[model samples]
Target: MDGFDRFRAPPPDMLVMRPLDSMVAIFHRPSGRTHVVASPVPEILESLGPDPTDVATLLARLSERFDLAAGDREALLARLGELEAAGLVERL
Candidate 1:
């Protein structure tokens, strides 16, 4: 997917995540599955609201807000792919 293709965070009613030290465990209600992740994944999901956010905007936001955040552009894209596969994010 390209940067122009928007992505949406999982609906709050359907997905929930709780912090576990530096990592987080995201519980997907519909799928009845949990995904544990760290760093940019949780931050990325938090920045993604109910509205769709393109990769460019996501990257821009992260760059602007975080000084020591992990993952460069390539890694960020890969992380997005992982989130999509986990059903934590969806294409718009």
Candidate 2:
């Protein structure tokens, strides 16, 4: 949780993502694994531009782009945890 501002998407060269309707199929070149992720995941990755971003900044950006509810922090954080666990994102 420390250094949250250092959170960033995985290295671009290590991922190959493709949209599949409402879902996304991400192929991790490093792990040689494929993941079928839903909304928020794809959206989150897209929102994470080319730089590291903190939760607050990311939340604000996501809110502007998506129709997020009044309180979606927990949900987004939870999804971020999952993505980190899956090695799609990292905290520096």
Candidate 2 lDDT tens digits, 4-81: 545688667777899898888999888899999887787798787548888888888998988888668777777778
Model 2 TM-score is: 0.83
Estimated TM-score per prediction? 0.83, 0.83
lDDT of all predictions, in order shown?
A: 0.81, 0.80
Distance from true location, Cα of 29 in model 1, Å:
1.3
Clashes of each: 0, 0
Q: Which residue pairs show collisions in model 2? A: none
Worst 10 residues of 2 by lDDT: 1-10
Instruction: Kindly report the root-mean-square deviation of model 1 from the true structure over all alpha carbons.
Output: 2.3
Pairs in clash, predicted candidate 1: none
